[model samples]
Target: MTPQFGHFRAESGAGPLRAPMARWMIALVVLLFFSAPALARTAPDSFAELAERLLPSVVNISTTQTAEGQSGIEVPVVPPGSPFEDFFKEFFERNQPRQRQRRATSLGSGFVIDARGYVITNNHVIQDADEISVILQDESRIEAKVIGRDPKTDIAVLKVEPSDKLKPVRFGDSDVARVGDWVVAIGNPFGFGGSVTAGIISARGRDINAGPYDDFLQTDAAINRGNSGGPIFNLQGEVIGIATAIFSPSGGSIGIGFAIPANSARPVIEQLIKHGAVRRGWLGVRIQSVTDEIADTLGLKGVSGALVASVIDNGPAKKADIRAGDVILEFDGKPIDQMRKLPRIVAETEVGKAVDVKVWRGNKPVTVKVTVAALEETEEVAAATTRAPNETPKASIPGVGLAVAALNDRLRSDYGLDEDAKGLVVTGIDAGGPAAEQGIKPGDLIVEVSQEPVTTPDQMAAKVTAARESGKKSILLLIEGDAGLRFVALRLAAN
Candidate 1:
């Protein structure tokens, strides 16, 4: 960084001794004033003390994966009646390919969360391992067993029966950690046990799509392969985050590392220790972001909150009368300023506890009481993919740039829509129109226009006309496609 300085001068002529002293004091004051901000970002003198204290608590995790595989000793293919055929057959008899159980070992890093022998590491570390071992700083290895693990957050808690009390580090308040704060990471990178690296917190609340609960803390710390599940400590030596992933193309640390915030991982860890699984609060609603265009169509002051696409059948959201198109503004007393924040907030809510959910409906805020339910861990059937239809539609909707038609039995079969589906089916979309720009495809079903049901193309056109005549720049549309329901806002200016 470029150095910044301020100029200051002493008052003209006083006592000879006082004049020089005044200038020195004035310069000192100005320099400090100009340097305070940079001083706040200054790096620590050394991380040696912190690393030395933390190394004992951080451990190296070794996992052995035993898998059945055929040996690679290929038998030679000799031509019939060849001169060396007999020799080749005898040589290949003893060296025939055979099935073998191969044992593969991998190394990862974790920390001692409890002295009674509870270790914290990434789930992927010992996912299918036959044997797990934890190595401390003094090179002592102890056989460990998995207590519980949460694959969603990539966190796992292991149990190791140690003869002596283990050194453990407490979790720090990750919410109090600000971006640009200094952080230290101690882990076993590339099998180098107890390696320490230092960097600043680059960002927070990063959603890398790793899982539904993806509130990760990003740092520039040099975390590499064996660094997964390692502890990222603040200057006070408290674990503020757990290193889980890195953004690199070369399979090495490119200075972009992601860690699970201590505050976010704490509840999951505690639940795993108590119950073998995590019982997360579920609102049972499929949601999407309220984009700028959607905000304009809904007459919202600003773009915020998660837009409800579809409430699960007979789920908590449906029981609470939270319909599709409702924007979840606040949950349980916490304001949801962004769409992604709602999921994490809702999941952290206590299951079966009734909470007030403030939603945006009919151009106004409406609060509803909802009892959060435990999320059921089940696999959902994959929806079929959609493509443009070769056949033409019954009618074309004007002003909205959609060639929509009244849904028929034949169109329903072509689009692979539900047998009991309602509303208009999009047979064609204008290539250069507003609908195409907003990702309105040919096989999608238009369920609602401006929060009102539209059964036919003419009704959709009428809704578009009403929105345009009402001086609205855009019209809101709820579309149901293979990917599920989503709200789209198309501009009406081209009409």
Candidate 2:
């Protein structure tokens, strides 16, 4: 009996099928032999060479702070003749004088950026430390002094006089670093120095809400607590980022880590070294993100750019005639891709330099020249200013389903509004109306409609009608509330 051949296999004890089976096996072996090399090229053969060269430049940072201890806990109140009162008082007396000053120490990692002993680390690492020290790869301890620190970027520069010249690493362009590029990080994790980890760039342009300029590069590298301020290097052994934070629930490496890109940190580091502080340019305007609703209301093609909520008085933007309701599309020729990018770009710009700002106004692009100003140390305070009384009469705006009243003495008293409050106070709203659907409550005061001041209910109604007649599907309203001012878009009711 002869055994039959089935899909690349043959029955046992069938000598006739041996020749075909052998040929199939040979073909499979040949395919694997040719494809193995291609598969092997996906990952690096070894990170040892890169790690060895970069380890010397990495240093361990140790800080010591003298913290004052509490004397004792306060005794709880007890009823008269309570038996536990005596015991509690005795416990407090025994522990009162035992409190004393103690030294607290922390460990982190950093890298040498210059041969002259200038090092870069996180600002939080050595903050408020009474004594700071750096431990080198050769196990030599050197005292370091804080050169400058920027809390905004969480970067700090340190200076140390070493016995021998130090090895330094140069920065690489992080902008060119793509996702999935191989990266290496050398740091002291949990006080264990000279540890190295390798991974790929997991993501870029991540906003972790750590700071204002939060363009962080996310990596799956095993970054731990003591890795803060350490350098994240590319395959070329160039510093591309500084390890700043990590996202973990167990207080250990879950592989998600964040680093400040070299491009964003380099300028701040340079400014710190030269001026001992970072000088950020100021474009004094309050900005919010443009949502789909706002885009449709403003007749924009897409949801992009930063919507100017309010312009600071006498600021660079106000002086340049940048008003509220303007959508800033570009600054200094760079497109404002999102609301957050504008702040970072403006801060990096040179103070006192004139730059062209393109804004979307009246459904068209308008270019305005604004001389950037130095940001003041103090933040702008929104002081309540009294508005002059207007005798405008009240009216009902049924198109948007709003019943508003003028800001008069009687209305202010009824609404419990401050005497300084001005605008058309919303007294009633229909449940199914667009205004009510957008969270416009009965107490909200409509200060501006389509960026024009509306003191009376009639003015607000007229503005809404005009916006609808002009083919706008919705209108932008600046509403004032107990919290602050905010912009809202209310859709127009169909005729």
Candidate 3:
């Protein structure tokens, strides 16, 4: 028989006056939860000592320009024929300035990259300035001169003669920086002198549509309008990236900031310092993504590379025996992971270096050694081959949207078919038919069906008839349009 108990369970002979274990359990649970985060917090380091060691390197950039100011100008119209108007008119007549404008001022941030007082900042920060000054952390301001500026990349270099040797910061390798690495940003945000914010690298190789070379290092560190051209430091306090832009609708810190990766900007900086401009190597080839259908058509095992749609004639690729149908698997020993990477690598490579290119052509792998050349505008190539003349239409199927015809030159030229094109033209598209729904319009060249090439009307009819006989609902047609080739999945209706 069970004994009746109220709101409690106990073993036989258990003690009734027991200390509560729930409070201890709750305390232990709370301790366990707070331990990890509390241990992860960084100890606060005094910036006064740190700034004393590094402040000599940091510089406050002030720029002034003679722009037409709306304020502090005497009114041009007479104020109720007051005597002051006559005084203003006489003053203006005496000073009759060639350029009627007042001076404007802007502030920004920069750092000395060289002991000789060579500093770096964004081009937009100091653009159109009549006067520029570099204020050191010691409250000593030196007049600066613009050495060079690159508007495309928004980088500028300035020179200031310091009375003493300036501490210079070296750029770190940004390519080795991974996500989750510790980073810090130092700049004059909102004109506040030498502010510092710390965070981890949020992402890498970010493209914010800023420039052609948009390999930005995304970070969560606070970056504002005046933060442009400031140094983004790694854990070693080396400059790894330049804080350039942020993506915040409110123009405040939403934790999304973009910095130009040192891997991309370092070379350009060197070029700018040496020659005052950047000269990127170009290949002059148009490329497209390697889709699944394209990979299958090319007999590639995986879709992991770029597809050469059309090689520019007399360009680097064409001069190096790179053909139209070649699928580039690797360039310069680096795997072509995506189509966008090709342009960046090609632009960074030396123009005269010999590059080894691996390509897939006709179900076989081939290696081509190509000497890179300078890019230029391409010229059109004349027709080298012609299509066979088309015979008249033999039959018009009742349900299908197509009128069949033999491959012909007249139809080929009219369709602007490719040199190797040999496809039966789709003469008509049935209204509300499967072909029409799949965007297979009239005069489209039907190149292949079910991965088999079709040239004549009888061949196309046989393929369709076989597909229907095989109990297939969808017929895949490789249609060639004015742009290029693409696959269309069409659902077959009941015959």
Candidate 4:
């Protein structure tokens, strides 16, 4: 059948035209296969629609600070006959004013967090602002009144009286936001109104040393100078973070931006909205991380807890028998991952709630119940009793060559120390001794050695000898000064 069709079709003149038409049909099919998806992928969709939808809630914040000159500006006393007198007179006389007023103005971005004219922004945005004003996208200006400010977390709330209900944004749970989720940032970057940039959540839990409660969500959005107080929104248009900072060498955004997580800000913002301030729970204890050496000295196999340096007398921890040197492993059933985490957890706990505290003491874990106390601005309480008053002084040891003295009333006054600073003061330092080489100087107090309290030079010396006998090359010392206490590691010398 195929042989008969070839012989019959070639007999007609239409065969030649059909061959050229077949080549054109093949080329059309190949072009359509490649160019269809390419045209679909490169089409431009303007972000103006999204900007128009979000610009109503975005705002610009402007702050003003009046700086003053120092008092008593004096002209230089130059001899009348001196050659440089005329030059000095010409230079200084022009600016001879005793005082000058300087003014500072800054701009940042923020968003409406409520419809009743309540707003949220970074505390630093309007911090120290003599006057604060918010500029809306519609060119409406409104004076903002500060409701509250939390410097610890760098958050602030403000209120404005608008003629009508303003658009407000709801917060999204930052904890549920996954990495790589699309995010959009609406801010006034470089004084431009309602600038929008789209990117993904680059990372989370960035510290960045911005504040004490620094749990930031890192994003690649275009955050900049004026973006400081803006809102970073998720794809669903919920505020997940407040744009607060950026990392760039040229003082601009280079796609590395940080925002305070909504999870950490939600409670603070709610409290500020309701009570005009944040009321955190406080556990009055100075804590430090337990190092490997500290764990070994305390007869533990590893370091994984916070060491209680001192519990405030009559405070929550002290009332609960949480003693110094105890390792706090868990608090309120939440495991304390690090020393810094403990402060945040304790502060976030509800005040007056009895919480279970798991601590390690003497190679054992003990769970104690502690009632959380309200964290006040001025929490002045009696210091813990570390030693008995006027106890018999122990004789100083001579072998290790550390000169020590008992804690006395005169010594305490001389050292400018608190009455409760229970330790032997190092009075002298050997010229080339290991302690001196380790920067231990006279008048410095030795509080602890190898996790044991040292009240005299003999105790310190004995502890060092014991540690060395156990094949340890370094000794940990809890050193204290007029300011406070710190831990130090010193290399021990072989006798």
Candidate 5:
């Protein structure tokens, strides 16, 4: 019997082949219908709309500086046998001027942040420039005066008198920007104004060692020379960062660029505009990163927070009873995820404002109320004091793990200490003792024990015994090392 070519029958009249084929086709169609939107959402159709809207606010910055220096001339290399080499060298040398004064021009990028012609750019771009000019999108050039410049953050605020209200861009919350979020950079690359590039945020909180506040947003955008001080925008066309630097070996963009987050720049910019200077809060303490060894010694579960190395006398931290060897876990309710984060947080806080500081002390958490102070530009120098020489003999504190002697001329010469240094010289230390674990070396000078001056071994030993008798678990020793003066808290070993 002949069967139809297009149709098949199931065994025992169970079903026809067309029904199953029809169901499979329907399922495929449904999947395509739902997935069409997902495929379309992968990337934007074009960045034209966003670029057009943001270009008006972006400006090209041109700076000219009067440089007075000698200009060097390089002689072109020629074949050894070339007869004209000597003649050419002599002619160039005779004509070359030894010293000259000329105008050096540099180019950069910036964005208008206010309609009254307030612009923002990197401080390095206009540094030392005798004159500054801003070129708008329409090619209108306007001279700009420096409102303020902050070298620490590398931010500068400029003012220009435009004929009309200028286009300004607003800052977006860069804290919420994720690593893979799309970003657009508008800048004047290589003096070409109104240039645009797009990429995703490669990483966040990148420290390039540019400044004390080194938090930067790293991106893969094609940032090059003249792109410095430009704005990095998010998908909503809001400025999330300022393009400040690039990690390029060839002086060109290699898909690795860094931008200062808008969140960090906003406060600095506001202060620059308002007061022409930044007023940063200070805690007056020398802090170091909490290492694994330090964390273990402090009985901490994790290696997080900043470790207090020394506290400034009469400073906010000292006034609050925050002692040396305390690990600052949080500042102003913000978790200090790392040591570098604490300085930026404290600096951004308002001066004279009392904030709760959570620190890890003696294997426990302690909260102290500290009033932040205004950070001074000048550092405090410790005053040198003269102490009468003590004739006490050498003494050993067995539990404390150190043998000390008077700071005599012999000991000073042997240890290479300063001649005028007055302290108890540590002659020997137990390698496996608590003092050694706290990085105490044999040549370390014990200047003070529990805030009392100790010029001789007997004085230090007495202070240690007194501290132990008072039920103190640790004794704070002010030590002078090769680097400088610092404080070390050593656990009191059982007698």
Candidate 6:
């Protein structure tokens, strides 16, 4: 129906306007029903109230470093009394002194975590600084000393003696912060101290290859060079993230910034304060992501958890009898939804505490109690071993795209294999075949077929035949190469 609302505002002829006004009200009500929810969120009218109070807690950090002198260019000895002799001598004398010593400075951001003078910032900010200075909002400059640093996560803590009571900010639960929630970032972007910018959490659980433990919270805030180590605060004026890096092509804010989540950073910060260094919990195993093909081949219900590539010798996993091919489904009662989640969970676990580890082994679930141990800075995974060979293959197996040979003394010497290395080494690969497509080389060792250890070519063939018979269409293999051991899934095809 065509409703005419022009007569609704006709005050002089109220009797005629009454019906139209009622119809206009009805149309408005109808339009509201098909619109956004009544409680839809909107931009806060202003962030000034939150910014004003948080400014004091955020700090500006300046670091000074004296770089080593550059090598002095050889000043040719000009002929005595030559016209160029004096100019050459003076130039050489002037540049030599300046080149011998130089001072460099850098600026970044941090926040007060404790009113007793404990501050938090990025390790790269004060990494090589000979002197660190923390600048407050009131223009007061104080010297800061490094308390501890963890390069893996790029987090650092500093201590300063403040003359008065310092304003400190508390941490909020970062795990609860969603992608669309509004956030405020206060930092010293490009040396502009006490600067505040607002944006929403762009993403979370981002792995930008910055470090091993890279569960960074992505944001679109104006994070630049000096914004490193600043706090990403939620609307409640609590710290939820610590700004660390940006993904800008032109070295300016293109809205892509990354921050260390408060939930991850808080524990490390506390450990750094309690001890001079971080003592991470170590679960000795080399793990890789569980692929869908691998899950299907191993009869797993779903593609999840970390697939153990190799178990370290005499370590926590070894002591608990966790095998090399087991898929760790849970650790300390927390479900490992992804492979990367295990490292962080294990690191946060208490040292020497016994925890239940659930793994997928033998096509079923197996639980073992493992005692956590302190992580050594120089920890290395020991070599994986295979059983003794039974018989060598006479020819290439046409169903599989790779040919395996039993390890021999001559072959071991040719490939520089250790004395105890016992496995079916890949002797040949057909061109354009499954193994070749997967980048398997000739010297690589086949350690396991699916989850069982393969000693001879016949054993490897039997496992492949069983997988094909079971309608898996592919087989999982544990290959040991120069880089280390890894699991590879190959489709069933002719060599």
Residue runs of model 6 more than 4 Å from their true location after superposition: 1-40, 71-99, 379-394
Model 3 C-alpha lDDT per residue in residues 1-495, reported as the tens digit of each score = 533332232432345444255445555666777697746645436434544455567677889998764444554887778988888788887866555587888888888889988998888889999999988887788999988887767888999988898999888999899888878788888888788888789999887887666778999989987888888887666789988889999998899999887777777777778988666666656667776656665667887877775577777788888865577888889888777778778877877888898887778888888777754434546543333344545455434566756556666675556556667777766777878876776566777776577777777677777767877666656776654566564666767
Better of 3 and 5 by lDDT: 5
RMSD to truth, every model: 6.6, 10.1, 12.3, 12.3, 11.1, 8.2
- Model 1 per-residue lDDT tens digits across residues 1-495: 553333323354456766676667777877887888867766778988888888899999999988999777776787999988998888878667668888999999999999899999999998989999999898989999999999988899999998889999999999999999999999999999989999999999998999989999999999999999899999999999999999999999999999999999999999999997888999999999999999888777788889999899989999999999999999999988899998889888889999999999988999999999998889889768656465863577676676888887888777777789998888887888888888888888899999889987778888888888889889888998878889988888556
Task: Give the TM-scores of the predictions, in the order they appear.
Answer: 0.87, 0.82, 0.67, 0.73, 0.74, 0.85
Count of clashing residue pairs in every prediction: 0, 0, 2, 0, 0, 0
Candidate whose TM-score is highest = 1
Q: Report residue 238 deviation for candidate 2 (angstroms).
A: 1.4
Candidate 3: misplaced stretches above 4 Å?
1-52, 66-104, 128-130, 375-495
Candidate 1, pairs of clashing residues:
none
The TM-score that candidate 4 achieves is 0.73
lDDT string for model 4 (188-287, tens) is 8888877899888999888899766777899998898999889988766789999998999999889999999898888999899889988889888888
Error of 2 at 183 (Å): 1.4
Q: After superposing candidate 2 on the true structure, give the runs of residues whose Cα lies further than 4 Å from its correct spot.
A: 1-42, 72-98, 380-396, 399-401, 413-420, 429-433, 466-471, 493-495
How do these models rank on TM-score, best leading? 1, 6, 2, 5, 4, 3
Please list the residue runs of candidate 5 whose C-alpha ends up more than 4 Å from where it truly belongs after superposition.
1-41, 69-99, 379-406, 413-442, 446-479, 485-495
Superposition-based RMSD of candidate 6 using all C-alpha atoms, in angstroms: 8.2
lDDT (Cα, tens digit) per residue for candidate 5, span 1-495: 432323232322345756777556556766887688756435688999999999999999999999887777777888887998898888888988777789999999999999999999999999999999999999999999999999999999999999978989999999999898899999999999999999999999999999999899999989999999999999899999999999888999999999999999999999999999999999989887776645655678888999887788989999999977788999999999899999999999999999999999978999999999999988557544332243344478857887788877767666767888878887777888888988887777888776568886667778788878877777777787765666676778988
lDDT of 3: 0.75
- Indicate the worst ten consecutive residues by lDDT in candidate 2: 385-394
Query: In candidate 3, how many clashes are counted?
Result: 2
Worst 10-residue lDDT window, candidate 3: 3-12
